[model samples]
Target: QKEVEQDPGPLSVPEGAIVSLNCTYSNSAFQYFMWYRQYSRKGPELLMYTYSSGNKEDGRFTAQVDKSSKYISLFIRDSQPSDSATYLCATLPGGTSYGKLTFGQGTILTVHP
Candidate 1:
Protein backbone atom coordinates (compact mmCIF):
# COMPACT_ATOMS: atom_id res chain seq x y z
CA GLN A 1 0.00 0.00 0.00
CA LYS A 2 1.11 3.55 -0.62
CA GLU A 3 2.40 5.45 2.37
CA VAL A 4 0.04 8.34 1.76
CA GLU A 5 -3.44 8.51 0.26
CA GLN A 6 -5.64 11.43 -0.85
CA ASP A 7 -8.93 11.64 -2.75
CA PRO A 8 -7.71 13.68 -5.71
CA GLY A 9 -11.02 15.50 -5.55
CA PRO A 10 -12.28 17.24 -8.64
CA LEU A 11 -14.31 18.97 -6.00
CA SER A 12 -16.51 21.87 -7.03
CA VAL A 13 -17.97 24.54 -4.82
CA PRO A 14 -19.83 27.79 -5.29
CA GLU A 15 -17.92 30.94 -4.62
CA GLY A 16 -17.78 31.98 -0.94
CA ALA A 17 -18.11 28.42 0.25
CA ILE A 18 -15.76 26.50 2.47
CA VAL A 19 -13.51 23.85 0.93
CA SER A 20 -12.04 20.95 2.86
CA LEU A 21 -9.37 18.50 1.72
CA ASN A 22 -7.71 15.58 3.45
CA CYS A 23 -4.95 13.00 3.29
CA THR A 24 -3.89 9.93 5.28
CA TYR A 25 -0.44 8.51 5.76
CA SER A 26 0.64 5.07 6.91
CA ASN A 27 4.14 5.85 8.06
CA SER A 28 4.29 6.77 11.70
CA ALA A 29 7.79 8.14 11.30
CA PHE A 30 6.64 10.97 9.06
CA GLN A 31 7.40 14.15 10.92
CA TYR A 32 6.81 16.83 8.33
CA PHE A 33 3.63 17.54 6.42
CA MET A 34 2.79 20.04 3.72
CA TRP A 35 0.09 21.24 1.35
CA TYR A 36 0.72 22.66 -2.08
CA ARG A 37 -1.57 24.38 -4.57
CA GLN A 38 -0.90 24.07 -8.27
CA TYR A 39 -2.57 25.80 -11.16
CA SER A 40 -2.85 23.92 -14.41
CA ARG A 41 0.43 23.68 -16.36
CA LYS A 42 2.33 25.38 -13.55
CA GLY A 43 4.42 24.29 -10.64
CA PRO A 44 2.94 23.95 -7.19
CA GLU A 45 3.45 26.57 -4.51
CA LEU A 46 3.66 25.69 -0.86
CA LEU A 47 0.51 26.58 0.97
CA MET A 48 1.20 25.09 4.41
CA TYR A 49 3.96 23.25 6.22
CA THR A 50 3.84 21.67 9.66
CA TYR A 51 6.30 19.72 11.72
CA SER A 52 4.96 16.79 13.76
CA SER A 53 1.42 17.39 15.09
CA GLY A 54 -1.00 20.26 15.60
CA ASN A 55 -2.75 22.87 13.48
CA LYS A 56 -1.65 25.90 11.53
CA GLU A 57 -3.98 28.56 10.20
CA ASP A 58 -3.28 31.37 7.76
CA GLY A 59 -5.86 33.77 6.47
CA ARG A 60 -8.62 31.77 4.81
CA PHE A 61 -6.66 28.54 5.02
CA THR A 62 -6.01 26.11 7.87
CA ALA A 63 -3.95 22.94 8.08
CA GLN A 64 -4.36 20.21 10.67
CA VAL A 65 -2.47 17.08 11.53
CA ASP A 66 -3.37 14.16 13.81
CA LYS A 67 -0.45 11.88 14.37
CA SER A 68 -2.48 9.24 16.14
CA SER A 69 -4.69 8.69 13.11
CA LYS A 70 -1.99 9.48 10.63
CA TYR A 71 -4.29 11.99 8.98
CA ILE A 72 -3.91 15.56 7.75
CA SER A 73 -6.37 18.11 6.47
CA LEU A 74 -6.60 21.51 4.83
CA PHE A 75 -9.53 23.83 5.15
CA ILE A 76 -10.26 26.89 3.05
CA ARG A 77 -12.83 29.41 4.10
CA ASP A 78 -14.71 31.70 1.72
CA SER A 79 -13.15 30.05 -1.26
CA GLN A 80 -12.92 31.93 -4.56
CA PRO A 81 -12.63 30.97 -8.21
CA SER A 82 -9.00 31.96 -8.05
CA ASP A 83 -8.70 29.06 -5.64
CA SER A 84 -9.37 26.68 -8.49
CA ALA A 85 -6.35 24.45 -8.62
CA THR A 86 -4.88 21.10 -7.66
CA TYR A 87 -4.04 20.49 -4.03
CA LEU A 88 -1.37 18.05 -3.00
CA CYS A 89 -0.60 16.62 0.44
CA ALA A 90 2.95 15.57 1.15
CA THR A 91 4.99 14.13 3.99
CA LEU A 92 8.58 13.50 4.99
CA PRO A 93 9.36 10.26 6.81
CA GLY A 94 12.40 11.84 8.45
CA GLY A 95 15.52 9.85 9.37
CA THR A 96 17.62 9.12 6.26
CA SER A 97 14.98 10.58 3.95
CA TYR A 98 16.57 14.03 4.32
CA GLY A 99 13.21 15.84 3.97
CA LYS A 100 12.30 14.21 0.68
CA LEU A 101 8.57 14.58 0.39
CA THR A 102 6.22 11.80 -0.58
CA PHE A 103 3.15 13.26 -2.24
CA GLY A 104 -0.42 12.20 -2.62
CA GLN A 105 -2.44 12.19 -5.83
CA GLY A 106 -3.42 15.81 -6.18
CA THR A 107 -7.01 16.85 -5.55
CA ILE A 108 -8.45 19.22 -8.14
CA LEU A 109 -10.75 21.93 -6.89
CA THR A 110 -12.92 24.40 -8.82
CA VAL A 111 -14.59 27.31 -7.12
CA HIS A 112 -17.38 28.47 -9.40
CA PRO A 113 -19.13 31.79 -9.66
Candidate 2:
Protein backbone atom coordinates (compact mmCIF):
# COMPACT_ATOMS: atom_id res chain seq x y z
CA GLN A 1 0.00 0.00 0.00
CA LYS A 2 1.16 3.61 -0.55
CA GLU A 3 2.47 5.28 2.56
CA VAL A 4 0.11 8.12 1.95
CA GLU A 5 -3.31 7.93 0.34
CA GLN A 6 -5.69 10.72 -0.55
CA ASP A 7 -8.77 10.82 -2.64
CA PRO A 8 -7.91 12.65 -5.82
CA GLY A 9 -11.24 14.35 -5.51
CA PRO A 10 -12.53 16.33 -8.41
CA LEU A 11 -14.64 17.82 -5.69
CA SER A 12 -17.01 20.53 -6.78
CA VAL A 13 -18.79 22.96 -4.54
CA PRO A 14 -20.62 26.24 -4.88
CA GLU A 15 -19.07 29.47 -3.78
CA GLY A 16 -19.10 30.20 -0.03
CA ALA A 17 -19.25 26.52 0.82
CA ILE A 18 -16.91 24.86 3.23
CA VAL A 19 -14.55 22.39 1.63
CA SER A 20 -12.89 19.48 3.37
CA LEU A 21 -9.99 17.33 2.18
CA ASN A 22 -8.50 14.31 3.88
CA CYS A 23 -5.57 11.90 3.75
CA THR A 24 -4.54 8.76 5.56
CA TYR A 25 -1.06 7.31 5.98
CA SER A 26 0.36 3.94 6.89
CA ASN A 27 3.60 5.20 8.42
CA SER A 28 3.81 6.02 12.07
CA ALA A 29 7.36 7.33 11.72
CA PHE A 30 6.23 10.44 9.93
CA GLN A 31 6.89 13.48 12.08
CA TYR A 32 5.79 16.36 9.95
CA PHE A 33 2.66 16.91 7.88
CA MET A 34 2.02 19.55 5.27
CA TRP A 35 -0.58 20.70 2.79
CA TYR A 36 0.19 22.34 -0.53
CA ARG A 37 -2.05 24.08 -3.02
CA GLN A 38 -1.29 24.04 -6.71
CA TYR A 39 -2.98 26.05 -9.37
CA SER A 40 -3.27 24.88 -12.94
CA ARG A 41 0.05 25.10 -14.79
CA LYS A 42 1.81 26.23 -11.61
CA GLY A 43 3.84 24.56 -8.93
CA PRO A 44 2.41 23.84 -5.54
CA GLU A 45 2.82 26.33 -2.72
CA LEU A 46 2.96 25.24 0.89
CA LEU A 47 -0.23 26.05 2.69
CA MET A 48 0.31 24.55 6.14
CA TYR A 49 2.64 22.32 8.15
CA THR A 50 2.52 20.73 11.58
CA TYR A 51 5.01 18.75 13.54
CA SER A 52 3.62 15.64 15.25
CA SER A 53 -0.12 16.03 15.78
CA GLY A 54 -2.31 19.04 16.30
CA ASN A 55 -4.45 21.56 14.52
CA LYS A 56 -3.34 24.66 12.65
CA GLU A 57 -5.45 27.23 10.95
CA ASP A 58 -4.67 30.16 8.69
CA GLY A 59 -7.33 32.47 7.38
CA ARG A 60 -9.85 30.32 5.52
CA PHE A 61 -7.68 27.24 5.78
CA THR A 62 -7.32 24.74 8.61
CA ALA A 63 -5.17 21.61 9.01
CA GLN A 64 -5.54 18.77 11.47
CA VAL A 65 -3.47 15.72 12.27
CA ASP A 66 -4.20 12.61 14.31
CA LYS A 67 -1.17 10.49 14.95
CA SER A 68 -3.17 7.75 16.60
CA SER A 69 -5.36 7.27 13.57
CA LYS A 70 -2.68 8.16 11.06
CA TYR A 71 -5.06 10.59 9.46
CA ILE A 72 -4.91 14.25 8.50
CA SER A 73 -7.33 16.77 7.12
CA LEU A 74 -7.58 20.23 5.58
CA PHE A 75 -10.62 22.43 5.72
CA ILE A 76 -11.36 25.56 3.76
CA ARG A 77 -14.15 27.82 4.90
CA ASP A 78 -16.09 30.33 2.82
CA SER A 79 -14.59 28.95 -0.32
CA GLN A 80 -14.18 31.03 -3.46
CA PRO A 81 -13.56 30.44 -7.13
CA SER A 82 -9.99 31.58 -6.60
CA ASP A 83 -9.57 28.48 -4.43
CA SER A 84 -9.92 26.13 -7.37
CA ALA A 85 -6.76 24.06 -7.39
CA THR A 86 -5.14 20.77 -6.54
CA TYR A 87 -4.43 20.06 -2.88
CA LEU A 88 -1.71 17.67 -1.82
CA CYS A 89 -0.91 16.13 1.55
CA ALA A 90 2.73 15.51 2.38
CA THR A 91 4.80 14.03 5.17
CA LEU A 92 8.42 14.02 6.29
CA PRO A 93 9.83 10.88 7.87
CA GLY A 94 12.91 12.67 9.26
CA GLY A 95 15.27 9.75 8.77
CA THR A 96 17.44 8.94 5.76
CA SER A 97 14.64 10.53 3.78
CA TYR A 98 15.42 13.80 5.49
CA GLY A 99 14.23 16.86 3.58
CA LYS A 100 12.14 14.67 1.32
CA LEU A 101 8.37 14.61 1.38
CA THR A 102 6.14 11.64 0.62
CA PHE A 103 3.14 13.08 -1.11
CA GLY A 104 -0.41 11.94 -1.56
CA GLN A 105 -2.29 11.82 -4.83
CA GLY A 106 -3.57 15.35 -5.11
CA THR A 107 -7.23 16.24 -4.69
CA ILE A 108 -8.69 18.65 -7.21
CA LEU A 109 -11.20 21.21 -6.07
CA THR A 110 -13.39 23.61 -8.04
CA VAL A 111 -15.50 26.33 -6.58
CA HIS A 112 -18.19 27.62 -8.89
CA PRO A 113 -19.49 31.12 -8.79
Candidate 3:
Protein backbone atom coordinates (compact mmCIF):
# COMPACT_ATOMS: atom_id res chain seq x y z
CA GLN A 1 0.00 0.00 0.00
CA LYS A 2 1.13 3.59 -0.50
CA GLU A 3 2.67 5.16 2.56
CA VAL A 4 0.46 8.18 2.36
CA GLU A 5 -3.22 8.13 1.44
CA GLN A 6 -5.66 10.96 0.95
CA ASP A 7 -9.15 11.29 -0.38
CA PRO A 8 -9.14 12.59 -3.94
CA GLY A 9 -11.99 14.90 -3.17
CA PRO A 10 -13.42 17.00 -5.90
CA LEU A 11 -14.96 18.69 -2.91
CA SER A 12 -17.03 21.75 -3.57
CA VAL A 13 -18.02 24.32 -1.00
CA PRO A 14 -19.44 27.79 -0.91
CA GLU A 15 -17.25 30.72 -0.11
CA GLY A 16 -16.74 31.51 3.58
CA ALA A 17 -17.16 27.88 4.57
CA ILE A 18 -14.68 26.01 6.67
CA VAL A 19 -12.86 23.27 4.82
CA SER A 20 -11.17 20.17 6.12
CA LEU A 21 -8.61 18.01 4.37
CA ASN A 22 -7.18 14.77 5.73
CA CYS A 23 -4.52 12.14 5.03
CA THR A 24 -3.27 8.90 6.53
CA TYR A 25 0.05 7.09 6.36
CA SER A 26 1.45 3.74 7.33
CA ASN A 27 5.12 4.70 7.47
CA SER A 28 6.53 5.09 10.94
CA ALA A 29 9.69 6.81 9.74
CA PHE A 30 7.84 9.91 8.70
CA GLN A 31 8.56 12.65 11.20
CA TYR A 32 7.62 15.80 9.36
CA PHE A 33 4.26 16.65 7.87
CA MET A 34 3.46 19.13 5.14
CA TRP A 35 0.53 20.46 3.16
CA TYR A 36 1.01 21.85 -0.32
CA ARG A 37 -1.34 23.80 -2.51
CA GLN A 38 -1.13 23.63 -6.29
CA TYR A 39 -3.10 25.94 -8.47
CA SER A 40 -4.11 24.92 -11.94
CA ARG A 41 -1.12 24.47 -14.23
CA LYS A 42 1.30 25.44 -11.47
CA GLY A 43 3.74 23.62 -9.28
CA PRO A 44 2.78 22.89 -5.72
CA GLU A 45 3.74 25.39 -3.07
CA LEU A 46 4.32 24.62 0.55
CA LEU A 47 1.24 25.78 2.38
CA MET A 48 1.93 24.63 5.92
CA TYR A 49 4.08 22.14 7.79
CA THR A 50 4.54 20.70 11.25
CA TYR A 51 7.21 18.72 13.00
CA SER A 52 6.14 15.64 14.92
CA SER A 53 2.68 15.41 16.43
CA GLY A 54 1.00 18.72 17.01
CA ASN A 55 -0.94 21.49 15.46
CA LYS A 56 0.42 24.48 13.59
CA GLU A 57 -1.84 27.32 12.66
CA ASP A 58 -1.19 30.24 10.35
CA GLY A 59 -3.96 32.66 9.61
CA ARG A 60 -6.63 30.78 7.70
CA PHE A 61 -4.75 27.51 7.50
CA THR A 62 -4.11 24.91 10.18
CA ALA A 63 -2.00 21.76 9.91
CA GLN A 64 -2.19 18.94 12.42
CA VAL A 65 -0.15 15.80 12.89
CA ASP A 66 -0.70 12.72 15.00
CA LYS A 67 2.21 10.35 15.19
CA SER A 68 0.53 7.63 17.18
CA SER A 69 -2.11 7.17 14.54
CA LYS A 70 0.07 8.22 11.64
CA TYR A 71 -2.46 10.74 10.48
CA ILE A 72 -2.36 14.36 9.40
CA SER A 73 -4.88 17.04 8.56
CA LEU A 74 -5.31 20.53 7.19
CA PHE A 75 -8.12 22.93 7.91
CA ILE A 76 -8.95 26.11 6.12
CA ARG A 77 -11.11 28.78 7.65
CA ASP A 78 -13.23 31.32 5.82
CA SER A 79 -12.80 29.70 2.46
CA GLN A 80 -12.59 31.81 -0.68
CA PRO A 81 -12.99 30.98 -4.33
CA SER A 82 -9.34 31.75 -4.90
CA ASP A 83 -8.56 28.97 -2.46
CA SER A 84 -9.74 26.47 -5.01
CA ALA A 85 -6.86 24.20 -5.87
CA THR A 86 -5.33 20.79 -5.46
CA TYR A 87 -4.05 20.20 -1.94
CA LEU A 88 -1.52 17.51 -1.23
CA CYS A 89 -0.42 15.98 2.02
CA ALA A 90 3.21 15.02 2.31
CA THR A 91 5.55 13.39 4.80
CA LEU A 92 9.29 13.32 5.13
CA PRO A 93 11.51 10.96 7.07
CA GLY A 94 13.96 13.01 9.02
CA GLY A 95 17.72 12.50 9.46
CA THR A 96 19.78 11.23 6.52
CA SER A 97 16.73 10.77 4.36
CA TYR A 98 16.31 14.52 4.19
CA GLY A 99 14.69 16.19 1.14
CA LYS A 100 12.59 13.16 0.35
CA LEU A 101 8.88 13.83 0.54
CA THR A 102 6.21 11.20 -0.03
CA PHE A 103 3.00 12.74 -1.22
CA GLY A 104 -0.57 11.57 -1.31
CA GLN A 105 -2.71 11.62 -4.44
CA GLY A 106 -4.01 15.09 -3.62
CA THR A 107 -7.52 16.31 -2.92
CA ILE A 108 -9.21 18.79 -5.20
CA LEU A 109 -11.21 21.58 -3.63
CA THR A 110 -13.31 24.32 -5.10
CA VAL A 111 -14.74 27.17 -3.14
CA HIS A 112 -17.43 28.84 -5.16
CA PRO A 113 -18.25 32.48 -4.80
Candidate 4:
Protein backbone atom coordinates (compact mmCIF):
# COMPACT_ATOMS: atom_id res chain seq x y z
CA GLN A 1 0.00 0.00 0.00
CA LYS A 2 1.06 3.57 -0.55
CA GLU A 3 2.32 5.41 2.51
CA VAL A 4 0.34 8.54 1.72
CA GLU A 5 -3.37 8.95 2.33
CA GLN A 6 -5.70 11.66 1.14
CA ASP A 7 -9.46 12.17 0.86
CA PRO A 8 -10.62 11.07 -2.58
CA GLY A 9 -12.85 14.07 -2.97
CA PRO A 10 -15.01 14.94 -5.92
CA LEU A 11 -14.96 18.34 -4.34
CA SER A 12 -16.99 21.16 -5.79
CA VAL A 13 -16.58 24.85 -5.03
CA PRO A 14 -17.78 28.12 -6.43
CA GLU A 15 -15.53 30.30 -8.50
CA GLY A 16 -13.30 32.60 -6.44
CA ALA A 17 -13.57 30.25 -3.48
CA ILE A 18 -10.56 29.22 -1.54
CA VAL A 19 -9.87 25.53 -2.02
CA SER A 20 -7.71 23.44 0.25
CA LEU A 21 -6.30 19.97 -0.41
CA ASN A 22 -4.48 17.85 2.14
CA CYS A 23 -2.60 14.57 2.54
CA THR A 24 -0.95 12.54 5.32
CA TYR A 25 1.71 9.87 5.30
CA SER A 26 3.00 7.24 7.68
CA ASN A 27 6.49 7.01 6.20
CA SER A 28 9.07 8.99 8.08
CA ALA A 29 11.51 8.16 5.31
CA PHE A 30 9.77 10.42 2.88
CA GLN A 31 11.76 13.62 2.54
CA TYR A 32 10.47 15.09 -0.71
CA PHE A 33 6.87 15.84 -1.70
CA MET A 34 5.07 17.08 -4.78
CA TRP A 35 1.59 17.88 -6.02
CA TYR A 36 0.26 17.26 -9.54
CA ARG A 37 -2.87 18.30 -11.37
CA GLN A 38 -4.33 16.11 -14.08
CA TYR A 39 -6.92 17.11 -16.60
CA SER A 40 -9.08 14.69 -18.51
CA ARG A 41 -7.24 12.70 -21.16
CA LYS A 42 -4.02 14.37 -20.15
CA GLY A 43 -1.00 13.35 -18.12
CA PRO A 44 -0.56 14.77 -14.66
CA GLU A 45 1.10 18.17 -14.61
CA LEU A 46 3.57 19.06 -11.90
CA LEU A 47 2.05 21.87 -9.85
CA MET A 48 4.47 22.27 -7.00
CA TYR A 49 7.05 20.55 -4.83
CA THR A 50 8.29 20.87 -1.25
CA TYR A 51 11.44 19.43 0.26
CA SER A 52 11.16 20.62 3.86
CA SER A 53 8.81 21.93 6.49
CA GLY A 54 7.52 25.29 5.30
CA ASN A 55 5.04 26.97 2.97
CA LYS A 56 5.74 27.76 -0.69
CA GLU A 57 3.47 30.06 -2.63
CA ASP A 58 3.17 30.55 -6.38
CA GLY A 59 0.68 33.14 -7.41
CA ARG A 60 -2.72 31.79 -6.29
CA PHE A 61 -1.46 28.43 -5.12
CA THR A 62 0.27 27.51 -1.88
CA ALA A 63 1.92 24.25 -0.86
CA GLN A 64 2.77 23.55 2.76
CA VAL A 65 4.59 20.73 4.45
CA ASP A 66 5.05 19.83 8.12
CA LYS A 67 7.43 16.92 8.54
CA SER A 68 6.88 16.68 12.30
CA SER A 69 3.22 15.92 11.64
CA LYS A 70 3.76 14.12 8.33
CA TYR A 71 1.21 16.40 6.78
CA ILE A 72 1.10 18.22 3.44
CA SER A 73 -1.35 20.70 2.05
CA LEU A 74 -2.23 22.68 -1.08
CA PHE A 75 -4.35 25.79 -1.05
CA ILE A 76 -5.84 27.66 -3.97
CA ARG A 77 -6.97 31.23 -3.73
CA ASP A 78 -9.65 32.64 -6.07
CA SER A 79 -10.37 29.25 -7.50
CA GLN A 80 -11.61 29.03 -11.06
CA PRO A 81 -13.55 26.51 -13.10
CA SER A 82 -10.41 25.95 -15.09
CA ASP A 83 -8.97 24.49 -11.94
CA SER A 84 -11.16 21.40 -12.27
CA ALA A 85 -9.00 18.32 -12.28
CA THR A 86 -7.71 15.36 -10.33
CA TYR A 87 -4.97 16.31 -7.90
CA LEU A 88 -2.30 13.84 -6.87
CA CYS A 89 0.23 13.99 -4.05
CA ALA A 90 3.57 12.27 -4.45
CA THR A 91 6.40 11.55 -2.02
CA LEU A 92 9.97 10.44 -2.38
CA PRO A 93 12.72 9.61 0.07
CA GLY A 94 16.07 11.18 -0.83
CA GLY A 95 18.05 8.32 -2.33
CA THR A 96 19.40 6.97 -5.58
CA SER A 97 15.94 5.77 -6.56
CA TYR A 98 14.28 8.98 -7.65
CA GLY A 99 12.05 6.85 -9.86
CA LYS A 100 10.47 5.22 -6.81
CA LEU A 101 7.59 7.26 -5.44
CA THR A 102 4.50 6.72 -3.35
CA PHE A 103 1.33 8.37 -4.49
CA GLY A 104 -1.99 9.18 -2.91
CA GLN A 105 -5.30 8.35 -4.51
CA GLY A 106 -6.11 11.50 -6.39
CA THR A 107 -8.64 14.06 -5.23
CA ILE A 108 -10.93 15.43 -7.90
CA LEU A 109 -12.04 19.04 -7.71
CA THR A 110 -14.32 21.29 -9.71
CA VAL A 111 -14.73 24.99 -9.35
CA HIS A 112 -18.03 26.16 -10.76
CA PRO A 113 -18.81 29.59 -12.03
- For every model shown, what is its TM-score relative to the native structure? 0.95, 0.95, 0.97, 0.95
User: Mind sharing the TM-score for model 3?
Assistant: 0.97
Q: Per-prediction count of colliding residue pairs?
A: 0, 0, 0, 0
lDDT of 1 at 93: 73
Question: Cα deviation in Å at residue 64, candidate 1?
Answer: 0.1
| Best model per TM-score | 3
The digit string of per-residue lDDT tens for model 4 on 1-113 reads 55899999889999999999999999888888899999999998999998878999999999999999999999999999999999999998866355587889999999999
Instruction: List residue ranges in candidate 2 displaced over 4 A.
Output: 95-97
* Candidate 2 lDDT score relative to the true structure: 0.95
TM-score result, candidate 2: 0.95
Model 4 alpha-carbon drift over 4 Å, by segment? none
Task: Please report, as a residue range, the 10-residue window in candidate 4 with the lowest summed lDDT.
Answer: 93-102
lDDT of 3 by residue, 1-110 (tens): 89999999899999999999999999888888999999999999999989999999999999999899888999999999999999999999877455788999999999
Per-residue alpha-carbon lDDT of model 1 for 42-90, expressed as tens digits? 9989999998899999999999999999999999999999999999999
Q: How close is candidate 1 to the true structure, as a TM-score?
A: 0.95
Worst 10 residues of 1 by lDDT: 92-101
Q: Quote the RMSD, in angstroms, for model 2.
A: 1.3
